[model samples]
Target: MSKVTPSNIEIIEIPKIEDPRGNLAVIEKEVLPYQVKRVYYLYDVPSSAYRGGHAHKEQLECLIAVSGSFEVVVDDGASKQKITLNKPNKGLLIPTGIWRELENFSSGAVCLVLASEVFDEDDYIRDYKQFLDFKNQ
Candidate 1:
C-alpha cells in the first residue's frame, strides 16, 4: 500500500444555494470521490471527551460539522496536523490508512460522517504502534 499523510486530507467546499429562508449546501454525485456506503453522526458530545482513535484499512470518509464545531487530528506515521471544522459548507476528506483522533468538540456540536464502505471491525487499526508497523510494511 502507498503511504498516507496528513496532507492527503483535503477540505472540500460544498456547493451552496442561497434562498430567502436560509442557505443550502449539497453533497451529491461528484462532490465525493467514492460512493457513500454508510452514514453516521455524533451529537451532544462533551467538550472534554475524545473520539475516533483508529484508522481505516480500506475505507475513506468525509467528515462535516453540520451543527457546531470540532477538531480532527490526523497523523501519518511521521507527522500530524490538526484541522478545525466549523462550517456546514465544508467537509474534510480522510483517505485510508491515516490514524485520526477527534476532539475539542463545542457544545451541541454535530459531526456527520460519510463513509465509502460499510462498517467492518477488521478494517480498523486501533493501536498506534500497529498503525506505524502497518505503514512501514
Candidate 2:
C-alpha cells in the first residue's frame, strides 16, 4: 500500500479563458500529472444520493464540477478532509490509497472525471474495513 494521505490531495486550477460570450476552461497539456486514459461524468444525482464509497489502488482521478456543485470527503485511514467543488476551472486530484465519498450534489450537477486508467474492478477497494487493512499493510 502507498503512504498517500488526504493531505496529498490537491485543488488543481485549470486555465480559464475569458470571453464576451462566456468563459472557457481547458484541462490538457501540463495541467495534469498523468495522461488521461478514461473520462466519465456523473449527472442527474438526487440531493440525498451518494456515490464513490471506495478507494483506488492505482488509478489517479481528477474530479471537476462542470455544472453545479458537490462535496467530496477524502479519507486516508487516518485523516479526512471534506472538499466542495463548485468551479468548472477547479478539480480535486485524488491519488491512490485514499478513500473517497461523494455527496451533497446540487440539482443538475455534472461531475466530470478524468482518470489515469480504465475501469478495473481489481483496483478498487470497496469495503472500508478492507481499505483500512490495505492502508496498514
Candidate 3:
C-alpha cells in the first residue's frame, strides 16, 4: 500500500442532491471508501485546551464534519500535519498509527468518526510522547 499523510488524508465529498425543498447526502459502504466497522460522533464539546492527544496502533478512521468545522492535527512520527475539515459532505480518512488531535471546533460542530475496528483501549496510544516513540520504532 502507499504511504499516508495529511495531504493524502483524502477530502472525500459525498454525493449531495440539493433542491428548493431540502437536501440529501449518501454514504455507501466501502464507498465512503472503506469498510466502516464502528461509528461515533463528538459533540457538546468545550474548547479542547487539550484533546485527542493519541494514536491508534491498528485502527483506521474517517472523520466527517457533519454539522460544522474543526481542525485535525496529525503526526506521523517524523512530521506533523494540520487539516481543516468543513462542509457536511466532506471527510478525512486517517490511517493507523498516526497521532491525531481535534480542535478549533466551530459552534454546533458535530464530528462523525468511522472506525475500522470496534472499541478497544489497547489499540489506543493515549500518551503523545509514547506515541512518538512507538511510531518511530
Model 1 alpha-carbon drift over 4 Å, by segment: 1-5
Tens digits of lDDT, candidate 1, 48-70? 99999999999999999999999
Better of 1 and 3 by TM-score: 1
Model 1 lDDT, full chain set = 0.92
Determine which window of 10 residues in candidate 1 has minimal summed lDDT: 1-10
lDDT by residue (53-83, candidate 2, tens digit) is: 9999999999999999999999999999888
What lDDT score is found at residue 54 in candidate 2? Answer: 99
TM per candidate comes to 0.95, 0.95, 0.87
- Looking at model 3, the pairs that clash are none
Candidates in order: C-alpha RMSD to true structure: 3.3, 3.4, 2.8
> What is the Cα-based lDDT of residue 108 in candidate 1?
88
